[model samples]
Target chain A: MKRNPIGVLLALIAALALLASACGSDDGADSADEVDSGDTAESTSAESSASAGPLRVGIVAPSASNDLAFTQSIVDAVNAVAGDRELDIAVTDGTFIVEDAAAAIRGYAADGVDLVIAHGSQYGGPLQEIAPDFPDTAFAWGTAVDTFGLPNVAAYTVRADQGGYVNGTLAAQLSESGVLGVVGPIEVGDAKLYVDGFVAGAKAQDPNVTVNVNYIESFSDVALASEAATAHIQNGADVLTGTAQMVVGATGVAGPAGALWFGTQSNQTPLGPDFVVASQVYHWEVVLSEMMAEIDAGTFGGEVYTLTLENGGLVIEFNDGAGADSSVIDGAQATIDGIIDGSITTSDG
Target chain B: MWSDFFTTSVIVATLASAVRFATPFLLAALGEAVGQRSGVLNLGVEGVMLCGAFTAYYVRLNPSGWGWAGGMATAILAALAVGLCMGLLYAWMTLVMHAEQGISGIGIFLFGLGATDLLFQKQVGVPLPISGLRPIRIPLLGDIPHVGDILFNHNVLVYLAYVLVPVITLMVNRTTFGLNIRAVGETPEAADTLGVNVNLIRLGAILIGNALAALAGAALVMNTNIFQQNLTAGQGFIAVALVYFGAWRPGGVMAGALLFGLVSSTVLQLKTLGIVSGAASALTAMAPALLTIVVLVIVSRRIGQPSALTRPFDRNA
Candidate 1:
């Protein structure tokens, strides 16, 4: 077959066009009144000058909202907060490409959602752009580092590293190979920080611990994650931990091999019986509870909240099962309690 | 990494991987064989396979906690029904509406992906588990050296995959339906003039192809207890590629599937042994695909595709 130069050129042009579209952020702006119909349950009591209609909450997920771990937690949190009050919560899923996120935020703002919460760290830039457009609506985003808080948007998160550190300690003690493995979606700041914490925590538990870290480069590739775990296992890494949303593939590979596996987000003990040793779980209830309490107390505004062991934002659950038993759970619990009691402090302090 | 190859565990891992990889391809190919023999070229195999995988997982993982065997059966039947419906739909669209065959096949794929993803989100949330198929060791054969571990001690699907190859080969190369299918695919007008119910044969092919795709999906979920969103990961495409490798013959497809299985198993073995260093691991993972592309290039010259491949039959033509 003779290769067609024009066809190749057209294909290139099409690819370039797609890349350009995928690269740009959404710039469309929408007015608040156009979207929110006043019928949602409004607690007339929330401090942010309760509007005639119920609260309008918007959530933007850089990844799929169906992600049962991270994004799902935030969705559950919004649902919990909306459960009591007059609230209409709208969510846009699968916003990995930067521009789609901007469009989602603008659309939510136009809909007159009172509070806009962007779950992924990558949404920080777009959230900042749209927060100014909808000043009346409060904004809370989950960011790894210091939040560049805008007047309307506030960054809120916990010390994920702190919890990772505790879990790392557990993994180190359980690892027979002294080679521990960590699988994450991408090497972003948020994930990097977690890995750093895990390495530190592992070393703290046992000075000689060696940790191997690999990133799947995408959140959606479970097969890649499974292969990575198998490679790590083959390398004599007895314990495996992942920061991905669903640890099914990773756990599947690790469990059958009789290696220790740890999960992130929710307690995944149900995934593989006696496989997961510990999980760095985020208690969305704590964040939602605090937000609800503040809103009810008539004190809603842009405020960045950090939920750590001190405030119970994040906690580590060391698997108490006999087969996946770890003494490090006790040690980590003690450190957590000590931190809460002001006796122990991480570098963040 | 090479050390892993010599170890006892590596042998088990490779054996497991081969069985795992072969299950879906075997099922899909078996279905394709039925369709091809009936004189139809059903390109909607990928879509049907995905639908089967999703449906089977949902049935198995639903609150009842149906065992893996039940899940496989459900998946197989569901896929078969879907295949039957899709086959009828394709026949109606192509035979009645006279739409382009390639276009209709693409439409089927899009419909399957969207419908499955949406239904999965609404129904049985992600990460559904079926009582997975456990390995059963055959008495004397399972006790043999390295080969026994490779061939025996497989889940029911593995054995089925192995047994179905020859059964399908015999059924097609040796049966009346097989001749009818080949004739239909080659010269539809001639078959029609010969008093064959052209529509019936084509519809049967479509239904059978779809069911086989579904069984492929079932094998996938049964092997991996947990089902994630879009778990097939282009294995449907891989199965189609296998058809080309087998030169569209049952025996050829089976051999190609086993070859791909071995390639996959070898990669996993290398990873386990830490023999694949640094950037090589990524290459190792792609080994199966690369091997497939290479084999296809070499084999395409020897094997001729169906005369009416991808072409919807026209009464005038």
Candidate 2:
């Protein structure tokens, strides 16, 4: 049969279109190559100096590396530790879906990265399964403490409640309305811990103060967070705080309303420089450095690292832009000292 | 706990939030209703929304010293243009190439999601705040006690949504274009025989629908005053579902959106007031989606979907 030239041309064009669409879908991973290239540059420098290359670190996070929340906290820690060093770092971000995260984690392990960080609580179960497969690869997962009793798996979690307590104490002192609002993400993992501590700290400061907490049941729904913040303000909450990436929405509301806002996960001063009084900055490096040291010492896993105020893992970073009074700063410092010295317990009332 | 929830302040707050939250959904769903009514089902609304959101956010961030109002206008227009372009692509794939509507839409969605996130990482790097649209109170109506706070005080986009509902309803029910759309949706062959340009009408409907969906994205970012990855957060899908729940009518879609928005706001209010404990908050958070499903099931039998919905047209065939 004679094939029509026009028909063949159309077929070729259609095939190309199909291929283009398929390539477009894969473009998400291509964006990550920029991060990978940075790692390559560092590893190349390290390889020239030593028979063994730099300590390779791979991270799989649920949100963007710059989300200014849970994921960014660790990403910042990794970058800080990698600064002026030969440590290699690679990250696959926006892996909110568990299956996608699992694939990335497994890929990293297959590539023989020295340490793989599974950076979400949702990843605990998958790490439990994958860690055993890569027994030689050091695996660190958190906001959780389950190591699956595996020798190569290490778990790290933030004592976010400690910083939450400090924030709550300062909020209570600064709040003229004597009403504080907290917009939490899902009531699980570190988010719930932070809210519980904030409420406790507020009550500790003023028993008569009304502290309202709202869990939006989503870690990434900024719109819901904004609505929650607005609702809190309407109900006479002069001070607001929240955890996770979505808190940007809440902080946006609070900043414009001239309400005080406390933040967590990472420094939220960038979100609302004028309103953000202080943030419970998660210096994961405080724990990460220790974990890496332990890994270097042949303690590959079976240990859980906890970030605490006493250990300086969770730092209360005051936003200098917010114009917090000296007395307020002094009071916050006193509370931090109290928590560290075991004098003021952060237990939920 | 329940007493806290029943307070007038809580009710007023929830109602006000409901109106604000419903704006995006109503706009997007109404747009989708128009497209579905014209026989094309574009599941790429979510992707289109993401694109619109990023475009609006980028415009808002740079502003080029356009000032607040000018920047906001520029952002909305930019978002609309992106949405219209996306609509054209979807129309070409489904109308000309006869690609599977669902798969093509999924492709568009993935492209939107990836492309937006990539651009955000490269351009913005960090989520930044913008001077978003602020609320405007309607003169005497805004002073009418509870009703004023609930209905008459909202951002300009919310008011636009309120106005679009009636305008869209009229356009769909009482105009020549409306008649042609309905005819093409029901029977493209008959409409074609009657001298209606079936493909052109369908293409126009797709463009209009997607453009509005993109505007919905803009409304969302403007209302929130900030943008982040996946900022729409499945609101686009909910908007699509809302069309079915609304029985593909503007008024019905608005009702569906209001119901969802109110339920969601109330759930957060209840959680805030401690009427719903943390252990049960997850379940309460599901209330809006659950209610949507239950309502959809109840109304499934009464409302008929467009016959040509999701099916591509071929003149020769």
lDDT of each: 0.66, 0.86
DockQ of each: 0.09, 0.50
Would you list the clashing residue pairs of candidate 2?
none
Minimum summed lDDT over a 10-residue window in model 2 chain B is located at: B62-71
**Residue-wise lDDT of candidate 2 within B37-127, one digit each (tens)?**
9998878888889899889988898787566645678899999999999998888777887777776777677677767876787779888
Write candidate 1's Cα lDDT for A277-349 as tens digits: 7777777657766665565565544566776776776777666662644455666677677656766444452
The TM-score measured for candidate 2 stands at 0.94
Candidate 1: docking tier: incorrect
For each candidate, what TM-score against the reference?
A: 0.76, 0.94
When candidate 2 is compared with the true two-chain complex, its DockQ is 0.50
Task: Please give the distance, in angstroms, between residue A22's alpha carbon in candidate 1 and its true position after superposition.
Answer: 21
